[model samples]
Structure formats: C-alpha cells, structure tokens
Target: MKRDKISVVGFMGSGKTTIGLLLANFLNYFFYDLDEYIEKKEGKSIKDIFADYGEEHFRNLESFYLKELIEKHNKIVISTGGGIIKREINRKLLKEKTFVVFLDGSFEVFMNRLEGTEEKDKRPLMSLGKDELYNLWISRKPLYEEVATLKINVDSKTPYQIVREILDFYGKM
Candidate 1:
C-alpha cells in the first residue's frame, strides 16, 4: 500500500493504543494516540474535558486533532478515540489519508478489558449501562466498517499478536 499512515479505530477497550504502539514500532513509524494528544493540547484530562465542557466540545477537539494529525504527519500510526468515527468528515479523511483498521471485539471482551481499570471512567461514554453501550456499539460498528481498510477481531488476541495480524493483513509481513 502507498498509504503512509495507519489509523486504528474501534470501541473503547479494544486495544487500539497498545496495538498501535506495537505496530508503529514494528514498522518504524511514529505513533500518536489521539486522546493523549487532545489532553495535552487542552491541558486537561479527557474526563475533566467532558465534565467541564461537554461531550460536544470534546468531540470537536477530537475532530480538530484528527484532521490536524492527518494533514500534518506521515508514516505515523494514530490511535483514535472510539467515537472519532462518528463524524462523516473524519470518516472520509481517515479512509482517504490512511489505512484505517477497525479492531473488532465483543461487548464481553470490551467490558472485561475495562473492568477494574482507572482509565474506564476517563471515557465519557463508559458511564452508560450495558444496554446503552451495546446499542452504541451496534450503531457505530457499521461506521467503523465503512472506513476501515482492514478489520481484525481482537477478542482473544494479545497486543503483540494483534500487531502481527495487522502487519500481515497490511501486507507488511
């Protein structure tokens, strides 16, 4: 592929950050975690951003950084926030500018990974109940699929394994 960027998109707890770091290192690419980027730029934690402003403001930040990074960088692996794919502009930009990968997983896997973690509450949408979260997942899955160049089921995979799979799928192997 000629694409210089690899954008990882998926639901929360889908291991996008871990796998993105591993894949970037394996490919000798720079790695950018969008959430961390937003936090740094805004001088606040994601939880604080949502609490102080609202989800709308936080999402605007996500869209801004998503576009900025794609426009400004190359040969970088970007780990996007779960809801980043919700915006049509982001969807188009990611699909066109990068090899987008959707890390698919079951709700059980997502909940298990999130359970007992400090980072759980930092996710603005993590406050939802199982049904609400499930509905959100259902709604977003198609959007993720829409923009993805590759999709990997991550339910039983470790970070290293996921990286290898992505590498193979991306034809880097």
Candidate 2:
C-alpha cells in the first residue's frame, strides 16, 4: 500500500499527464509521461510509431519502457498510455510494482475532455471512431480496475480535488 512509485492509468483524456505532473510536483518526485518518454526514446510521435510499425510493435516498446522505468525509478509518478493495460504483463507489473491509480470516468466525460483538442488527433486509436474507442474503454475498464491500488472517479472532480484525494489516501497508507 505504501508504494513510492505512482502510476496513473485511464482513458486518453483522463488527465493522467496533468494530474501526474501535479502529484509529482507536490511530492517533489520525478514525473514521466510514458508516451512522451517513448517518443523521445524512439525519436518519433506515437502516431508515427503506429504507422511505421504497428500496434503490436508499439505495445512491445511500451511494455519494455514501462519495465525500464519501473526498475530504474523509485520516487516517481508515471502517466501511462491508455492501451498499456492491453498487455497482461504490463498489467501484472503495474499491479505488483506501483501504486496504480485508475482515474475512473464515463466514456462521455472522457470524450468531452478530449474533444476539440489538437492532441486528440495525435493518438493512433482516435482514428478508430467513437464507437470503437468506447468499446475499447468498455473492454479495458475492468483491466484498469483489476490493476488499481486506488481508483479515483474523475468525472465531477477538479484536478486539485483529485490530487488532494490521492495525497490524502497516500498519507493514510
């Protein structure tokens, strides 16, 4: 329960990077957006990765980098890509190694958060259409639940409120 590494997992628009940055700043810990890290490591956008290689290759890179970060860092906050949970090994690693926070929110809420945002276009799976993405959420919801150490409903809460809630829980544990 007292994990130093906190990994935030959720749908694409679930504020993982934003909240993870705040949480890490508040705690004076290292913050890594896994996607950004991947982009830097591979020298290309994730969309390019998907287009050049494939989702399978991307997932492999995601999993490999995830493990590298987990093993190398202790006091850290990780904002994971939405599809990281698609792999069983990634799920197990997160569940066992980090204080995994599943930022729970409805599909509509997530879509609204991301709507009209330029960054939305950068996501490979965004091309799959709303219905498919919603189904992806449906299928992955339980996987997030299964790996979460603390599940935070992000629908109605402000970012500050969510951070406070996580800090409060961290303090208790």
Candidate 3:
C-alpha cells in the first residue's frame, strides 16, 4: 500500500527540511516543516517559544499540532523536529499515521552541516557543548531507528541525492 503522507525524521543537520522539500517537489506533494508550522501557528519563532515557555511547553504544543496535521492533511511530506520522537504519543502517531523515514549521518557530518551559521545558534539545543551534542545525538539515534519505516544513511549524500534515494525506495515499496 502507498501511504499518502511521508514523515522525515532525523537528528539536527541530517537534512530533513532540505530533503523533504525536494522529495515533495518530486512527488508533487505538499511540504511542511513541523517547526515552521508551529512557529507560524503560535506567532512566535521556535527560539522565542523555547525562551519564553520552555521545552516542555513547546513539546506539548508539538504533540497537539502534529496530531492536528495528521488528522487534517494528506498527500504531504512532513519534516519533523529532531526531538519529536522523544515523546511516546508522537511516536505512536507517527508509526500508525505516516510512512516514516529516518535520515542518519555521522556526528562529524552533523557538525559540518551546522558549522559557521548564526542560524544554528537559534536552535534551543545548540547551547550544548560538543560532547553533550554528541551524546544527545547518540541517544536520539536509536529512537529514530525504532520509529522509521525506512532508514537512509546520508553521510555523503546531497539533498537531491537523498530525495532520489527516498523516491526510489518509496517506489519499490
């Protein structure tokens, strides 16, 4: 069976937004970035939400909006926040509602993607030092793996290449 919705999951810098955009363009589906959606709906940037309301509040909002999106949308490609898999309810929803793909990359690759960018500083979790970031990545990786219907290792792949791989794999399915 072909799922109407595809959810892209990964740690930060794993190219979820970039690849999801390309994949949606290729598939002629609507593309959504979960964080951007949340930000728009809340009328605040994610950084502002984190700063003012904290992560727990942001997470609750995330769950609410994700459920809303799943219930309301179809033929869409969703690029999810890195920590979306941290919640069991979100995991259950993702597993049951969407064809989820996990995009994985090495720590070095993640760092490289994030390097020399002021935008990177706006991410709430970016306050962590190098070791902490690596530890967080390691911890979250297994969760991503557990929820994924398909897993793509994106160590050296460009966004277009990743989209192509996803399209090919999705076609085979």
Q: For each predicted model, how many residue pairs clash, with residues at least 3 apart or on different chains?
A: 0, 0, 0
- Worst 10-residue lDDT window for candidate 3 reads 113-122
Could you give candidate 1's per-residue lDDT for residues 1-173 as a string of tens digits? 54679999999989999989999999999999999999999999999999999999998999999989988988999999999989998999899889998999898898889999988878878898999999999999999999989999999888888888888878852
Model 1's C-alpha root-mean-square deviation from the true structure amounts to: 1.3
For each candidate, what is the lDDT?
A: 0.91, 0.95, 0.91
Return whichever of 1 and 2 wins on lDDT: 2
Candidate 3, after superposition: displacement of residue 56 in Å? 0.3
Each model's TM-score, in the order given? 0.96, 0.98, 0.97
Question: What's the true lDDT of residue 159 in model 1?
Answer: 88
Candidate 3: stretches off by over 4 Å: none
Q: Mind giving the per-residue lDDT tens digits that candidate 3 earns over 10-47? A: 99989899988988899899999999999999999999
Top candidate, metric TM-score:
2
**Error at 41, model 3, angstroms:** 0.2
Residue-level lDDT of model 2, residues 1-173, one tens digit each, is 64799999999899999999999999999999999999999999999999999999999999999999999998999999999999999999999999999999999999998889998889989888889999999999999999999999999999999999999998989
Best by lDDT: 2
Regions of candidate 1 where Cα sits further than 4 Å from its true position: none
